[model samples]
Structures are given as C-alpha cells and as structure tokens.
Target: MFSLRARDAMSASWAVSLLSKSLTGFSFWIVGTGAASAHVKWFCAYDAAGQPRGLENVLCRDFELLLGVALLWFFSGCVVERTSLGELLVRSINRVTEGLRLHTEVMIRAVCGFFFISLWAVGGIILTPELKTTSPQVGLLQLAIAAGLLSRRTMPFSAAGIVVLFGLAVRDYGTFHLADYPIFLGLAAYLALTGLQKDLFGVPPLDVVRYATAVTLMWASVEKWAYPEWSFPLLIEHPGITLGFDNEFYMRAAGMVEFTLAFALAWTPLVRRVAAAMLLGMFISACFEFGWLDVIGHSGIIVVLVAILADDRPREAEYRAPWLAPAGLCAALTVTLFTYYVGHAAMFNTSIL
Candidate 1:
C-alpha cells in the first residue's frame, strides 16, 4: 500500500511538471509570433474598399468560444483589481518604474522625434509602409515634424504636422486604410495638449493617448476577424507563426488575444499597466522578425506603452463596480464589431451578411 501511494504521488508530480513546461513553451511561442500583430497590408495584397468576410463567417463557433473565454478572463481581472493583490502589484510596479515615471514626457517626445526622422529618411511612405507617396514634400514635412519635437513650444506644430500628414494619407488612401493608425492622431493630440498645457474636456494628454491606443488596437483586431485572408499570405510566407494550429483558427485566436489585451487598457491601473507591458514585449519581439520597418512604425506606440507602464498617478474615477468593467468590455466589443461591419458595408456598398 505504501509503495502504491508513493507511486501515485510521483506520477501526479510529473504530470504537473509537464503541464507547467508545456504552458511555458506555448507562451514563448506565442510571444515570438508577435510579428503577427504587424499591419498585414504591409506584407500582403489588401484593398481598403474591398468587402470583408460576412459577419456570419467572422462570428462563427470559434469566435464565439473565444469571446466567452475573453469575457471570463476580463471579469476575473476586474475582480482581482478590487483585491489587495492588485494594490500590491500596482505599488511594486510604481516602485520599480520610479525613474521612468519621472521622465515619461521627455521620453515620448524623443522617441516621436526619432520616429518622424526615420519616416523622412524612408520617404515615399505616408505614415506606414503600404501608404506609398511619390511627392518629395512628404519627406520634408516629416523632417519638420521631427524638428518640431525638439522644443515644448514647437511640439504643437509637430502635432499639427502629424495631422496634416494623416489627412494627406486619408486623401490618397481613403478612410478605411487610414483607420489602421488612429494612434498617430492620439500622439498628435498628446503632443498638442501637453505642449499647450491644456486638456480636452478635462481629460489629460496621456489619457488621450491611452484611449487612442486602445481604440487603434481594438479596431485593428476587428480587421483580423473581418479579413483573416489578408494575413494568409503572411502566414504562407512565414509558416512558423501558426504554431501547428490551422491558419484560420490561429488568426481568430490572435484577434481575440489582441482585442482582450487592448480592452484591458481601459480597466483598472494594475490591469492597464500589465497589458501595456505585455504589448510592449510583443512589439519588441516582432522587431526581430520585421527589422527596421517594424521598429520605426511601432516606435511611437512602444513609447506610449512604456509611458503607460511607468505611469503611477492615481486614477480618480476608475471602474469601482465589480460589473462595470465587464459590461464596458462587452459594449466596446459590440460597438467595434457593429462599426466595422455596418460601417464598412455602408462605405464600400456591400452587405454585412
């Protein structure tokens, strides 16, 4: 009897150890495919005005399953946010990021400066890789934007220049294509509001950037669901990113993860910081696969995420009700889905079904 009991215990222990290792390995694999988050249009053929897959196709069984899981995960995070554990985590993060917190603004400015200069260096690109331009003036405009970031007084001008560039991109590419990058407008808003020492309707500049980042990511995630085929070429080119899963299922899962993390950015302080940190890691890891374009294109968001991670300020009106966070998440998901499907259909003269 004693021998049998010991054997049973040893088997259980080994099983637990194997499970742990498997999960760890799986996580590393997921992180390594961080380039999966890159703008697919940059690497594949995409028509902004083309009709995306129908809502019925996108919201299939796999998507529903993922949505349920994401809801549970988000609700659990909200519950945790109310506990002492959340407070402790926030305190620890604040303590470790003390230096970063102090220089967040300067760091953001410097990074944006570098990003604009890189864009100028690579000219013929309107904001991102796919938005090509033949005009020499765009490069000069980017150079001016970079130069504006040199002084607090001139940062607003830089912000204006960013807006102008975005407008030009929209003019050339259309609203659907430009929708992939609201983060630029967020950066522009951040620079303008901070430089002018003003706030929009009482919201702080950094918060504006945070909200914009969340929206940008959420919107991008919707694209993955609506047009998973757009990324098929990328997967075909780099098969290793699938991690043994069917390519279609992998894209859906990727969209779920991105949407969930992006939604968490608007949650409690601890949750947002952790989400930002994870996203920052993903972006950095993606650079290894994508090289300079990923680095420069992601530089602005990386800086924003860093600032978010380092932010230690107390939020006066965070979601205190246990149910509010989950409700907000659901509402956000619904809105983005409706807008993407309905809005796209309307804009492109296609049916949502």
Candidate 2:
C-alpha cells in the first residue's frame, strides 16, 4: 500500500541493515577464529542459545582503538627528534645514581651465581607448562657453568657451555617456546663479555642484563594475550584474585599493563628501572595465586631486573626524548598485535572462533 518512493526507502534501509549484519558477522568470525588459533578467548559473541556466533563481543570493546592509539603515537614520534631532550633526561637519571657504584667483582659473582642456584634448584624446564620436562643433563651442564663462574679460571669456557645448552634446549623445546628464557643467553653473554673485559662490541654486562629483562617481559606479555584462556585455570582455582572484574577484561587489561611496562624497560633507563621494580612486585604477588612454579619460572628475569637497579644506563644505547621512547613502544606493540590477528585470521579461515 506504500507509494513508490516509500518502498524504495524501505528497500534501501533493509539493504543497509543486511550489509551491517554481514560485516559484523565477518569481523567476529575472523577475530574469534584467529584468536582461537592461539588458544586465546579474546574474540567471541555468544548466540541466544549460549553459543558463540560472531564478533559482536569484541566489536563492542575498544580493543581496536587501543591498537590505533599505538600506531598514532609511533608515527608522531618519528616527527620529533630528542637531541636536547634526550640528553637532559639522561642527565637527570644519571644524577639519581651519582656516586652510587656497585663493586664489579661482587656484581659479577651475584649475577652469575644467582643463575646457577636458581636453575640447579629448580632443575627443570623453566617451571612453565610449555617446558615442563627436564633431564639430568641440563642440571649437570648448569653445575659446570656455576662452578666455572665461581672459579673465574674457566669462566669463559663455562659461558660457552651455557651457549651449548641453549642449542640442546632449542632442539628439545623448539625455539618458539624456549625463547622465553632469553635471560639464559643474556647471562651467558655477560659471563663471556666480562671474561674478555666487555670486549664484544665494548658492551657492558649491565646492558645485556637490561636487554634480556626487556625481551623476557615482552615475550611473556605476548603469550598472555595469545593464550589468555590459559589463565582461566588459575582463576577458577583461585577465584579471589579476579578482584571483582570480569575474567576477559581483567586478562586483557593485565596484558596491556604488562606489554606497556615491558616496552618501557627497553626505551627509557629511568622508566625501565621503575618498570622492572613494578614487574618484580607483580611476579612476586602472582606467586600467591600460582605458587612456587611461578616463582622459579620467573627467577631468571627477576634477578636481571634487580641487576638493572644496581647498574646505570649502558653507554652504547641510543638516547631518545622521553616521549619518543614511549611512542616507539606503542608503535611496536600495535604492529606486533595487528600482525598476529590478521595473519592468523587469514591462515585459519572462519571456523576457529
């Protein structure tokens, strides 16, 4: 009974609605399936019968906006150089540590011995599910490295032993999972460099410690995002830790905090030191919820973070304006996460969510 113009308008409205529905569905399918590929529960909207149907849930969240902010910050930082600002910031940090010097002899002993005890005590694959298995060989190799460190006569040779263990571990656990313990390699680098009086690239041992700490955090943070559902087991076992937030929101926010702080550790010396302290606190607190395995697994990085506190900024590291460092961090994270989502979505197709 409607006029031609009215019918035409109704048809147009229906078409738009249909297109909206299709796009929304496609987005959800792509994201949910892609996330599932990584064992993550980040993207999914349940249907009326308590079933997941599409991207409606993730679409409602500001996840994309968060990523967008990272990209924008990164590009903007490229426009500003920190020639003066960087020097000033560096000077301020240095002033705080003025006249504070850790005895190199004591530091090398503590750093090296810490690894020996932590690994020998645990005597396993980093105390995580991924590297759950261990062998007597790994323990014996660790002992050799520890002994060499104590004697100083065979320190470089023992350091090489650590590198050999790295090869064995990669063969056992695969590079993807064992990459979490870059601190092992870092410690090896320290032992080797100090044996040669920091001869390799004239890099300081503390620089290796800082870099190892940063890489460890960033690597673990990404795992949290990709396998967020892995934490649900902990949540169900210890419900009080949720702190009244929804599981998904808490996990996502936690990932953001971790990744942000990890990036900070690499970019700014002052901020990196602060971030290390905060992360050490977080890891310690998590022990109550996850127990001793968590402690042992994180032991290497925790020691490295402490080492960072005792040491000053590395001479070789490039200086950047305080703001630019954070901006570049944002960009790195944005690109990393986006690539993961898009790549997996394409690889797995639509059934994954």
Candidate 3:
C-alpha cells in the first residue's frame, strides 16, 4: 500500500541503525583491548582543591607557593650580593669556568640543521605538545630558515621567526605557568640570538642553555614531592628502580636528587659538567619506564646538554671562594626546597614530614 518513495525511506533508516550499532561495538573493542594507552604528561599537575580552574589562570596553589619561595630566594640573593665573600666566589667561578667559545658561522649553521630536522621530520612523526597546533606552519618555516641560516648572515630572519613562535606560545599558554614549558621557548629565542653576533648580549649561549635546563629541572622536581602519588604507578610497574628502598623514601630521595643536581647546575660551571652528566643519565633511565614520549619531551634539553659536553673552552682565571659562598648556596637550596615541599603538601593535603 506504500508508494515507492516511502519504501525507500524505510530501507535507508534501517541501514543507518545498523551502521550506528557497528560503530559503538568497534569503539568498545578498541577501548577494551588496551589499544590506546596513556601518555607521560607534559602539563604540571593543577591545584584542584576548591574553586573552578578558569582557562586564563596561571597561579594554581602549588605555583603560588613556588612564587613565594622564589621571592624569598631572590631576597636572599640580594643579601648575598652585598657580601665580600660573594664577589670572591664570583671571581673564582669566573676563573674556573671554561667560558664559551665564540661560534664560527659554520658551527651555528650545523646546530640550525639539527634543530630543523628536530622540527620537520621527527616532529612530523610526533609533534611535541609545546609546539602548539601549527606543526605544518612551523615546519615549512623551518625549512626556509635552514636554507637561510646556512651562513650567519641571515640570522635576523631566524630570530624574527623564533620571536613570532614565542609570542604564539605565550598567547596560548600563559608565560608564568609551569605547564606551559616556557623554558624551551626562551631557549629557542636565545639560541636564535646566539647565531646573530659574537656573544649572546654579553652572555654565552651555553650558559643560558645550562641555566634554563637547571630551571626546568628544579621546577618539575618539586612536583614529585608535591604529588608523589602521580609517580606511584611507575613505582608499581618498576619496583626495581626504587633500589630496595620503601616507596615513600624512594620518592623523597628521587626528588632531592633532582633538586640537588638542578641547584648544582645553577651554582657554578665548576660542577656543571658533572651535574649535566648525572641529569642526562637520569633522563635516559626515565625513558625506559615512560617510553618514547619521555625522550621526546626532553629532546630539546638532550641536544643542549650534548653541546655543553662538546664545549672545550679553557679558563685562565680562577678565584678563591671564601667559606661563605658555598654556605650561602647550601642554605638557599635547603630553605627553598624545604618550603617547596611543605607548601605544596599544605596546599594539596600531601604529607611533607
């Protein structure tokens, strides 16, 4: 009794119903089979205690305490600057440091080539979260840049391009947020500057690389103390990495080890090579447990650390450190880390003691 059009509509509806059911079954199969696993995180953990997290906010409870301790550390630095011991230590360090060699145009070009590969092909394989969503845009630009930067003459354009990307990252992720991973952006911009002229605004590029790496280490290390539970899964999976210690002790010791290395990296180039070597080992060790994403997450740092090793500049000047400089540094580290652990614990209801 139905017309031909009515018969056709009923048949089409039946097909759609079958297709929908099939997709739902496939989704269940994919999830239930352990096909899609979790990734190592790029973002720092948030403070979700009370209020809602708005998109624009950079200050979670943990970072706010981080800022407070930093202010105290800065104040301590100001006090130390006025001491004769500080000047003595500085001169000693200046002498001991194998100050960076001025790069030849050839060397700068080489570094750019590696960075270009990092951005284009490797990045094409797996884009880092830090790269924003514009991989194609960034990759094509890097291709042109590598050609231009073959000599030091075209550095200005590279610098400008880096600046634009820096701005984009800041716009997307607030500059102050730890989760934003701002150090890489800062380092990329600084590396661009290093290619332009004799010195990086009177500072060495290696120094910036080391210092930036140190900052990143210290920043992330605190999270381990603050939210040790986040690392609980790793402990569960690989108990051997704990090396026979109880889990709680292992976490605290691990956090301290990271903090100490980071603190050492910033204190003196005297001990930096040792610290960098240790950090490199730790990064590689972490890669075994977390998988390739850990390596990708830290690749930028690994490149810079390698460059730090390749630097063989010798130092002619050395200074004697009065007892005060080392004492002050030790004191600063102790206070900052102690407060960092307790502050985070207080904020998030984790135990510090």
lDDT top scorer: 1
lDDT of 3 by residue, 111-180 (tens): 6556656667655421254444545776776676666666556666665665565666556544433332
RMSD of 2: 9.8
The 0-to-1 C-alpha lDDT of every candidate, in the order given, reads: 0.84, 0.56, 0.51
Ranking by lDDT: 1, 2, 3
Tens-digit lDDT track of model 2 for 1-353: 46988999999997885565444433332222111111122122211112222334433344444344433433343333245664565476556644434554455556566656677777664323344345777777777777887766677887798788778767775665465667778877877777767655755776776677677666656555555566666566556555554566545545555666667667655556556656666766665545555555555566666666545646455645545654577676756555444544554443224
Q: In lDDT terms, how accurate is model 1?
A: 0.84
The CA lDDT at 242 in model 1 is 74
RMSD score of candidate 1 (Å): 6.6
**What TM-score does each of the candidates earn?**
0.90, 0.66, 0.58
> How many collisions per candidate?
0, 4, 3
Candidate 2's TM-score reads: 0.66
Clashing residue pairs found in predicted model 1:
none
What are the candidates' C-alpha RMSDs?
6.6, 9.8, 19.8
Model 3 segments more than 4 A misplaced: 1-40, 43-127, 130-149, 178-182, 316-328, 331-353
